[model samples]
Every structure is written in C-alpha cells, then in structure tokens.
Target: MFLAWQEIKKNKLRFTLITGILMLVSYLVFFLSGLATGLASLNREAVDKWQASAIILTDESDKSLYQSSMSIEQLNDIKAKKTAVIGQLNAIASNDDDKQNISLFGINKEEFLMPNVTQGRAFEKANEVIADESLKDKGFKLGDTLSLSSSDQQLTIVGFTDHARFNAAPVLYANLATFHQVKFGEAADQKKDQINGIVVRDDSISKLTQNDELDSIEIESFIQSLPGYTEQKLTLNFMIYFLFGISSIIVAIFLYVLTVQKISMFGVMKAQGISSTYLSWSVVAQTFILAFIGTTLGFAFTLVSGAFLPAAVPVSFDLTLMMFYGLILMVVATAGAVFSVLTIVRIDPLKAIGG
Candidate 1:
C-alpha cells in the first residue's frame, strides 16, 4: 500500500489526469440521477401524499385515469373508510402578466389525500384554490387571483402546498363543485357528478373486489399511466445505467495500460522477494483510494450546485439511492483493479531479471 501511494505521488501528472476524468464522469451520473428522481417526484407526489394502497379507475378508460369518469353515485359504491374522489384536468391559469400550465386537482379538503398547506389556509369553497409551492416561481402568491382560460371564473389563491406537482406541471387543489363547473360546464341542477378515480385505504381492498366496473391497481401502477411519466423514467434510467457501464470500461482500460507499462517493474519487485499477494492487495487499495476521492468530489459538486441553483430546477436526491450509486461505483472500480492484479500474477521474475 505504501509503495502504491509512493508511485501515485511520483506519477502525479498521469494520476491527476485520470482522476479528473473520473470526477467528471461521476458528477454527470450524480446530477442525472438527481434530475431523474426529481422528475418522478413531480409525477407521483400528489398521489404519494395520499399513501393509499390502491387506486380505483373505471375499466372503460383502459387503465387511464384522465380518460376515466365516475359519478358520485358510482364512487359511493366503494367501501373504503378513507376513499377520496379525485378529478384531474389541465388548464392555463393566468394572472395579469403571466400564464402557466397547471394540473388541476379537485379534492375534498377533509379527505386523507389533501396535502398539508405550507402557507395561508386550505381551500374550503367553490371558487378558491390551493396551489403547489412551485407556482411561486411564476409570480403567484397567497391572496393573488388567477383566472382559468377554460371557464369564465376567477380562483383565489388561498394557500400553497409543497411537493404537489403532477405530470411536470404545478397542481392546483380546488373544491369538487368548482371542478365540475370548470370541467363539464354543467349547472348544479343537472346532477351530473363525475370524477377521475378514487383512492382507497389498504384494508378496504377486499371490499372493493365486489365491484366489477372499477379496477383496483396499486397507486404506483396508476401513476405510471400518466402522460410521459413512464417514458421519461425509462429514458433517464437507461442513460444512468449506460454511464455506469462507461465508468467500468474507462477504469479498466486505464488500469490495464498502467499495468502493462509497469510489467518489468513488477517482475523486478517479485525477483527481489516481494510477495505477489502484497502486490495484488496494493492494486486494489490504489483503486479504492482513487475511486473514493473522485466520487466524493463529484457529490460535493452536486451539493454545492444544489445550494446555488434556482428554485425551478428540481433536485430531490434520496439518500438511500445516492448511497446505492456510490456503492456501485466503488465495486466497478475495484473490479477494474482485478485486471491489474492478474497482470502482476503472470510476471516471470526469473526471465525478466536474466536469472
């Protein structure tokens, strides 16, 4: 191990160059991982806030919530203690100077799915709306008024909630009556109540089985059907895994060339009574030291960038996921060292030293 450190110190330029490349690759991986996680959060945060075991969507919509419609009477057929009838739609909400796309959610304030308000108070009336905190970026604040383009109505921003985005758009929580009026243009006397779906409690799964018109899929499965959610996740995951494969190849090629360059030196060391096992262990230790330093630097950059980045760029990296990624990097780097160890093992001390 001492000899390996000594060699790295002596070959400072070569090692430094390789280390810089490793650092950049790792930084790319970490940044992309955070972005992917943040995007998925935008898709699922609203439903995830409910913590429901399953969601019931009408079978007629072909497993799509946006296309499914259920009447209030049909929703009453579900026996869950915490059933929440939900309606989702997309519309543009504009203030005097700005307009932003929003995913509107109609939820009963008393239901379990209502997110906790971060500012002001929750909506309790037909014309009031609670918005995701993300809207603060678009010049909205509590007590502000927003007009929806699809209806001749104005909604007061009563409150703001955190982490309530849906399908990459800020979510607006409104009363069921307001949603019906804005979505269907139906008057109160018409009695045409419709909802996208219902989220049910975990223990009520058996009770819901009796209904054949609704299909109970896990909340995650329902989220997967959201537009662009599944496709974006798959594309990001493929890039992350591809980056991992590139790291392995990069480390392996660098170490193999370094090993080949030092074949004669290894042979001389073996002829001078140095053990092959010690040489192999040193190779692994070198790999660990370099990989550890490089990945640590990359994550440091991620943290610093998070601090300075504007609020709009989502950076929600889970600790467990980051730890798993670091582990994978170290393992692949160590595996690359094994090739150098093989080269050391094959050194012919007698032939090389002219014995």
Candidate 2:
C-alpha cells in the first residue's frame, strides 16, 4: 500500500492522465446504458404494468398484437385468477390541430391490469379516457378533448396514469366499448367484444394453451418480440460490451508498460529481500485506486448531465445496474494489473542490480 501510494504521489501527472481517460470511458458506457434501458422501457412500459404471467393470442398473428384478433367466444373459454381484455390501436390523438402519435389501449377498468389513476378518477363512461403522464409533454391536460382520426366521437381525458406506454407511444386507457366504437365506428357492433390479446394470471397457463388457435406466451417473450425492441437492445448492448473490452485492454497495456519501466527498481527491491507478494499487492492497489477514482468521477458527471439532458432522450438510470457495471469495471482493471505483477515476480535481483 505504501509503495503504491508513493509511486502515485511521485508520478501524479501519468496517473492523473490515466484516471482522466478511464473517467471518460465510464461516462460513455453509463450514458449508453441509460439510453438502452430507457428505450426498452418505452417499448414495453404498459405491458410491464400487468405484472402478469402470460399473454394469450392466436399463433396465426405471429406474436403481433395488431394482427391478432380474439373474439368474445375465445375469451369465455379461458379461466384465470384475474384477466383483462386489451384492445390496441394506433391512432393520432389530436387536440384540434395539435397531433401526437399514440397507442390507445382500451381496457376493462374492472380487470386486474387496469392502471391506477394518479392524477384523477378512473374512466367510468364511454368516450372518457385516461392518459399516461407522458402525454402531458404533448400539450395534453386534464379535461382536454382529443379526437381519434378515425372516429367522430371525441375522447375526453378524465385521468392520468404513471409509466404506461406501449411501442414508444404514450398510452391512452379507454373503455372496451369506446375503443370498439372508435376503431370500427357505427358498424362497431361487428367487432363488439373483440380484443387483440388477453393478459392472464394463472398457474395452469400451459394447460390453457393446449387448445389450437390459442397460445400463451411468457410476458418477457412477448416484449422481446415487439418490433425494433430486440434489435435496439442488441445494438446498444454490443456497444457496452465493446466498451468493457476496451477498458480491460487500456488498463492492461498501461500498467504493463509502467511495470516494465520500473524493472530495475523491482530488481533492487528483490535484492534487498522484499517479497514478490508485497510488490504484486502494490500493483493491484494502484489499479484499484485508479478504477475507484475514475468511476466516481464518471458517476458524478452522469448525475450532473441528467439535468441538461432533454426529455426527448430516453434514459433509464438504475442504481443497481450502474453499481454492477462499476464493479465489473474494477474487477477487469484488477485483472489487467496481474500481468504487471507477474513481470515483477520474474525479475532476477542480481541481473537487475548489475551486481
């Protein structure tokens, strides 16, 4: 510990430069991680709310909610502890000329999947709607009326819920009857009680899917199958993995070269009866200190940057995930320093000291 601190104190400039580089790398990795997490949440936010075990849809739809159609007959045949009918539609929610793309979810308010209202009362009448808090960014307000482009009926925002979104659009919760009316118009009777999917909580979900034309899939599988979700997550994760590799290489090469520079010093120390284990400890100590300082600086910068980041940028900052990332970085850094320790261990005292 003393040797490591002495070396760092003596050569402040080199260590400081290395720390700065590490800090920059950590910042990039953390920010990218946040973006990936945020985008994923946006993709599956509403479904995540269900906390259900399985979802039922027709296999013919190929896991697409928009294409899947389940009639009243199919819903009646299923048994569950609790179930919710969900009708999904893509439409423009317009307040006069102001328009925003939205995924309107028509839900049975009485069902277990119904979102809890945070700002106002739940929807109790036809044409009444509840929006995710995200819609507030688009100029929507409580009591604001938004017209679905396809329907003559106007939707009045009666409530707002937290963290409800699907496929990157703010969700609008409406009654199943109103949704049928908005989607199918006066001929809505033709599509009455039709639902895209059913979220069910049951222990016997596997048995429930034994029937042909109905399949029950885990919630995670359903989320991953959504368009662009898996692809985006893969691309972002690739970058994070690449950064981890780069961090390992940078720490290894830099420490290895620094150890090489101190070869003669190590030789003299060995000649003076110092142990290889102590010398190796010094090397690891330096690497750990560098990692600790760099990660702390990077974390601080990320926190400050949050205030400056725009709302449009989707970023999820999970403390547990970030801590895990930091821990991995430190471990990689320590592992990189092992090469330096080995170099010191192999040094011959007599040759190094030129006795």
Summarize candidate 1's per-residue lDDT along 1-355 as a digit string, tens digits.
7977888899989888777767887888888889899889988887787888888888888777788887777776777767888888889999887899998888787888788999999887888999999899899988888888888778899999998887778999998888877787746447347788888886657557457888888777788988888899899888988888787788888988998888888889999899999999998888877888788888788778877877778777776787688778777877878778898998898866667
Q: How do the predictions measure up, each by TM-score?
A: 0.94, 0.94
Model 2: per-residue lDDT, tens digit, 1-355?
8889889999999999888888998888888888899999999999899898888888898888888888856877677777777888998889964788899888888888789999988999999998999888878899998988777989999999999989999999999999999988988988887889988888767765555888888888999999999999999989988988898789999999998888899999988899999999999999999988998898889878976988888998877888788888778877889789889989999988777
For model 2, the superposed segments whose C-alpha errors exceed 4 Å read: none
RMSD (Å) of each candidate, 1 decimal: 1.8, 1.7
Among these predictions, the greatest lDDT belongs to 2
Clashing pairs in 2: none
Candidate 1 regions with alpha-carbon error over 4 angstroms: 186-188, 204-207
Whole-model lDDT per candidate:
0.83, 0.88
Name the weakest run of 10 consecutive residues (lDDT summed) in model 2: 202-211
lDDT of 2: 0.88
**Superposed Cα deviation of residue 63, candidate 1 (Å):** 2.8
